[model samples]
Target chain A: MKRSLKQFRYETAESLHIALFQIRANKIRSFLTALGVIIGIVAITMMGTAINGIDRGFDKSLAMLGYDVIYVQKSSWSTMGQWWRYRNRADLKTSYTEAINRTIEDNPNSNLLVAVPQMSTYQASVQYRDLTIEQAFALGTSYRYPQTASGDLSSGRFFTPTESAAGTMVAVIGDDIATGLFGEREAVGNIIKMKNSRFRVIGVFRKQGKFLGLFSFDNQVIMPLGAFEKTFGKKGFVTLRVKIRDQKQVDDAKAELLGIMRRIRRLPPQKEADFSINEQKAFKSQLDPIKNGIAAAGIFITGMSLFVGAIGIMNITFVSVKERTREIGLRKALGARRNTILMQFLIESVMICLIGGLIGLVTSFLMTWAIATALPDFPVQFSPALVFASLVVSVATGIISGLAPAVNASRLDPADSLRYE
Target chain B: METSPVITMRDLKRHYSMGEETVKALDGVDLEFLKNDYAAIMGPSGSGKSTLMNIIGCLDTPTSGTYILNGQNVAEMDDDELARVRNREIGFVFQTFNLLPRINCLRNVELPLIYAGVNPREREERATEALNRVGLGDRITHKPTELSGGQIQRVAIARALINNPSIILADEPTGNLDTATSQDIMEIFSDLSKAGNTIILITHEEDIALYTRRIIRLRDGRIESDKKQ
Candidate 1:
């Protein structure tokens, strides 16, 4: 057994050397054959890169939503944009946040942390002296708002508890709001006009990029909920942001919050609550199917191109076998077994594919870099796993394409092949 | 005491079916060769000499009768087993000097040992020794394309002898060479035979057959004569 294994190794080594020599001697033919694999690998790697970029961008957006936070609103994020289901539902009251927070504070073992009630309107406008910014997101929250969110204060401070309770006309402005209304001027302590009332800009938030390249977090004006009610009306859009003790316990936290909200609404035991409890995971569940759909379609299309490429390789390998008939006869006469001939052809095709795969990886890496440099917002990534997966695919393609020809070469009659003109 | 023959054939037959007709390529032929025998098979173009060479080289199987090489009945062997028999028991020299043109002389000579599963160091050593024996020791690194016809044939012969097989089979070994280079190749074969290597070759030229100690003539797939000069 050991001797056979040693012999197999020697034969494989000899085949590899012969394959290399054949490829080197026929450089143009080899490269042209390898081009099929090159195109296939490039398509595969680029597809993988695109999918990776989409995932990376989604993860970034999820991070901005704060993984540890969940939201209580009228419409669920998982069923997002299905406004008809939530249209007839009553608005989620901001006062429910206080009740939830009170229960969390009393229970020592609760997975719930803190809840911040938020009210906002996108139609609100802010004016500072002669400059005005329209369609700015005007939000209302309390002293605990920063705990459930991600951004940090760039200047001044959030409203103190006493100020929040007093309904003081003090606000924390977003980076875009501050920059738009003041334009490099000190925004803190500056008073801005909104809806016939003046409110002091107590703080400005650091710049936070957009979510999924759509909604901007930097364009908001956050103030005390009580103060926002007098200006934007009490019935404006409302959401309750709840911070959980651990993100891993989000399901438990959501269940706990659901019970709390049901009690706040005084719902009967048999009746279901009208509100929705949501987390970042809801967005994932909603988007994952779409993402998978894109991936499945991309893979099929890419697989088709690779299949065409493999057929090309198979055709070229057949021609190669036919061209080397005399050499095959000679080798067989000298002592090459059927398996040795098969292995020689197989190694040749596989070597070509491996080289093609490496070239494709390097090409995709450069293309990814160039794309990132040209459009910094474009989501595209090159990963080592992608490299590994594509190489395996290349090798499989080589074997699948080489098998028929190699077998034909192996089965050639040594005596007859020697006599072939 | 007389020793047993290294090669023995009993009623070997190879027939080809040609469109409803059976062409008897080799019909009921029998032969024997002792160890260190130098022989040539001579016949005309459709005389079954090539068929005999094919069967002797283990490249083809006979339809009937047993062929025993060194006491092993190789007639019934399967493809892979026959390959092993060829690798271990036979060396082949062809008319075209069938050296792989891309590889150097040393690599070409090492081809048989590779199939025989010899390790690299030993394969190189044995191949070098065989090449040196064939008088191409200085041209080990030269490709077939770089060497003369005589040198290429010597490389083929070295490859043939690398495994030290029981029989060296050459088919029309000098048919494509000039008279002078043919003499050189025959002289190398002569030297190999004198050194106790059993050698067999097939050719139609009597002058080429003169180099071997014995010659067998075939006609219409039957042995016509066996003569010793």
Candidate 2:
């Protein structure tokens, strides 16, 4: 038999045409065979899209905490594997925060560390003239708090440091809070009552969207720390929010704050400091292992789906070889080489996989869109690299599945094949 | 005999082992065919006519035989070499035509050259020429199912002739065709033979056997008689 790549390609293409025609002829059978592949791809895609969206959401949440800014909290914010242990600790006291503020004030080099106190309650009920909204969260912090609340200033101005120092009763409201307290009217300078204590709204926060059916940053009230302490009586203890000048100095600053707090509290050197220090980056780091686990699971399951698809392709190709035995004999008798036969069938198998994979890829993109719509915080990132990877996988499925059958077809004895019924 | 015989076989034997029994399909057969010879082998069922034809066409190798085809020892040739010889020196036309149903006439005719490693542009040109030679000039784009039985046979013949092989092997070439179509195919065979191509056919039909200049009869896995018209 004359053996050339050109002839092989031509015959391969011709054979693939026949295969497709056969598939088209048995539409229901072909569709049913592809159904498993379709379900697998869609399930994998949807799962992957959802997980990827969450990962992106996590990233956006981190982004809200500016990369250039370094946050210092009383407790280490990372809750990896020991959430209960951290949760059981006694809350850091307000006197510790006052001492930390004094320490930062006294040291010119540490003056970049802005010390602020926080007092928050999630079950607070608010009343605006006639309407009252229950289960609203109220936040009380120093005037410097808005600088850390990146999404907390949608309208009007944050309260000035002078007002906070003097313990003025000014608040920053979230969009939902503003709507509940002031209706459509401008909320700046409006007074809203929380726990029968009235406070003036200075700013309304931007909408931060929803997560798992819960409203986010746009539904809370932000008040100055001094006024919060006066009205709420500073009873539940306070967390010191410290801003560092440079992220590189966070470790040194943390050590300094712990030392100052310990000295002020007059604790012995052997005793554990009564506070924890936290960083936003550490919080993200805590979430990484879970995301990685989810990612690995997705890949493995998706890989199995592709394997199943390959098996389907091989089965179909084998059937095709059986059906075309006479044709194979005729071609051989006409001088088709073994390699030519092999290439033809192999290409046909690959084409089938390519078609299936292409449909899967398109469906995955659509699923990505749905994911983005539902969880806007999640960034469902679809990179060209992923597209390339999927295509490679599909092609690999084709080559691997089609190889044995194509070889079988190529090795067929012309005499036997011609005689095949 | 200044010119060597194109095919020569000595004591050619092919045996199939069916469990504990060995059935001799071709037993100690000796044969020779010169260049441009038009011949036929005739026999009843189980007479080994098909087996003999397979060995002669290089589609099967005889056990314990010295078979020299065109001065090359065919028995010693590997699978690739045998395939090459089959592609370059022999064209086979089955009784059923066996044209691929999905491909058009031209592509069917081009099958031989494809395995022969010809480029596409030349393959198309040569396939077109071969199809036209078989009097299928206009129906080159029509598929096998779209053509008449005689046309499909012609397309098969065109495919067989694509590489301009020295020998054309027809295995019960008219077994599936009606009398008229069979006669039409026989006429094409005569034309091919006249064009200096050696032709060998295996058939049981007396009428089909009579078309060739020579006839060899096989009986019970052995040559019974050989005669020239």
Using DockQ as the measure, which candidate wins? 1
**Global lDDT of each candidate:** 0.90, 0.77
Top candidate (lDDT): 1
Q: What is the lDDT of residue A305 in candidate 1?
A: 76
What tens digits encode model 1's per-residue C-alpha lDDT throughout B102-220? 78999999998888889999999999999899888999999899998888888999999989899999999999899999999999999988889899999999999999999999999
| Candidate 1's TM-score | 0.93
Going through the candidates in order, what is chain B's TM-score?
A: 0.98, 0.97
Candidate 2 structure, TM-score to reference: 0.91
Ten-residue region with minimum lDDT total, candidate 1 chain A: A328-337
Which residue pairs clash in candidate 1?
none
TM-score for all models, in order of appearance: 0.93, 0.91
